[model samples]
Target: MKDFPSCFGENGVQIADSSSSSSSSSSSISKAAQNLVTCVYQCKLRGRLSFIVLTWTKHLMGQGLSLQIQNSTSQSLCKVDIKPWLFSKKKGSKIFEIESSKMEIHWDLTNAKFGCGPEPEEGFFVAVVFDRELIFFVGDSPSEKIAAVSAAAAVFVARREHVFGKKLYSAKAQFSEKGETHNVSIECDTSGGLKEPSLVIRIDSKTAMQIKRLKWKFRGNDTIVVDGIPVQVMWDVHNWLFGNSAMSSAVFMFQTHKSSGSHSQSSVLNSSSSSSSSSSSYCQQQIKDSKLQGLDFSLILYAWRNE
Candidate 1:
């Protein structure tokens, strides 16, 4: 899969080059650890399937939001950026054209309430209308003006978030479109004077997966069952184990996969190698293939350690 940092693109955040000076590399990675959340939804635009990407960022001025619509081939159709300085322009609409179809985006965050994260907890509405038809809608209270289009209901496909904590990192995820939201907690003890560092993952306060001897198995994958659904958990923590802890962030992926008579959970875990290269390749292939069928849900987490 593409590294979580790449999803931010030019707006902000990027992976540092290996050849860069140590100080420069540290600055780059530190910038990427900022608070941000990106969500992907699959919906129909002009009767054709498309992907809508929404990114929420937190900065010194205030919160920022950006929207991008892309075709099946991942080509950008159009994009809009609502800067943090434009806080007074809370409620507005943007008009554009895509393939001769008039596309309109309306957002109202006048009373939007937010917690520690960039995403709003409630009191907001963002609607996407194509040719005057409501194709996508999000937020707790949608505007009373926009009518709904049944055929254009979007599917929640993927999410990427940056979480920070000392030892226990937590986030919320829904494995399927209709699935229940569950609390996800990742705990790893890597303090000094500790001989053996281990990793533990919990869902809704219940242990789902655990790893021992994390130093040796810094990168690996396993299968866990949550809400009777099989979720493939892959993690890469080489940086936290050996690299610069202050500037490095570990990655975790939780993906729900379909089970067939010929395929077994054991096979999936066994085929996975304890190396970053193999793990990355497997994840990219799975995501790329599943997007075509729209049958899987992916949750990616970038965990930053607190110094």
Candidate 2:
């Protein structure tokens, strides 16, 4: 059997379309901790495009990482898992082969630092070398050494995140490769009873956007400015309003665009994208393509309710 790549694999949690099987989502969300996060980076190697998924896991055991590299066709190329129980080491390296190419991945976090989340905050380094060329390097490692090892072959392109909260969900996001990362949060309280529900999103403690009467507007899109850049924000809250206990979630996509006149318009509701058919490959393709080139960077969020 071939090992397929999934964000939920290493964590022992596999999430499905809440709109279809709300019970499963509810059970899985209840078992999930709050400090876990997954990041997917679109990269280029030898003129070919691919994605690198880095999942940071945090539990009673400790902090670890799960990495999956896949080609543009969504086929899994390689996967590296650093499980806490099996290795008990703070830092190490792994080697693997892809189509007969010798590839090496190295990391050093013996003296690494971390914040409240599973992701490292400082004192860490991760490098990827292929056939003696440094394809990618991230951390405090000397920049000159990286350039000397090999020419730059990989670039951080896009990312995705999974956030959980009962009323407020937060995450750090960089709208551009060179943009400053800001603290962003989404606040919503649907316990309106007989009144209208409200949705508020803030970046760096500054209000960037707000939606009133979210119950009536369960699915839609709009433009919001974060750090002075126009970002198209699309949302689907059907599950929040009417999902079974297991299906209580809201999906949001914040896409940063380059053109100024390209956004700030109301979007037609697209139910087919996040409908019960969300498990379909077509839906997954649409979700991934939401970024790419003209669309630039995107922050996809799946906010789960604890209630």
Q: Which stretches of candidate 1 lie over 4 Å from their true place?
A: 1-24, 86-88, 148-151, 192-194, 258-263, 266-295
lDDT of 2 at 283: 27
For every candidate in turn, the CA RMSD to the true structure comes to 5.0, 5.8
How far out, in Å, is residue 110 in model 2? Answer: 1.8
Per-residue lDDT over 1-307 for candidate 2, one digit per residue giving the tens place of the 0 to 100 score: 0011122111112222212333444555534434456666666666677666666766667778777777776677777877756456666678888768877777776767878777887787777777677776667743344446855646554455557787899988988777898998999887657768888989888898888877666676777876667887767677787765643667777777766565546653445544543323322343444444256566667677776
Please write out the lDDT profile of model 1 over residues 1-307, one tens digit for every residue. 1233322211212222222244555545555445678888877765666888888877777877888888765678888888877445888899999889898988988899989888888999888888877888898777667755442677776788878777999999988667799999999988757468889999999998888878777776677887677787878777677765465677898877655222224323321354545445555554454434323677888777777
Worst 10 residues of 1 by lDDT: 8-17
lDDT of 1 at 295: 38
Q: Top lDDT: which candidate number?
A: 1
Cα displacement (angstroms), candidate 1, residue 167, comes to 1.2
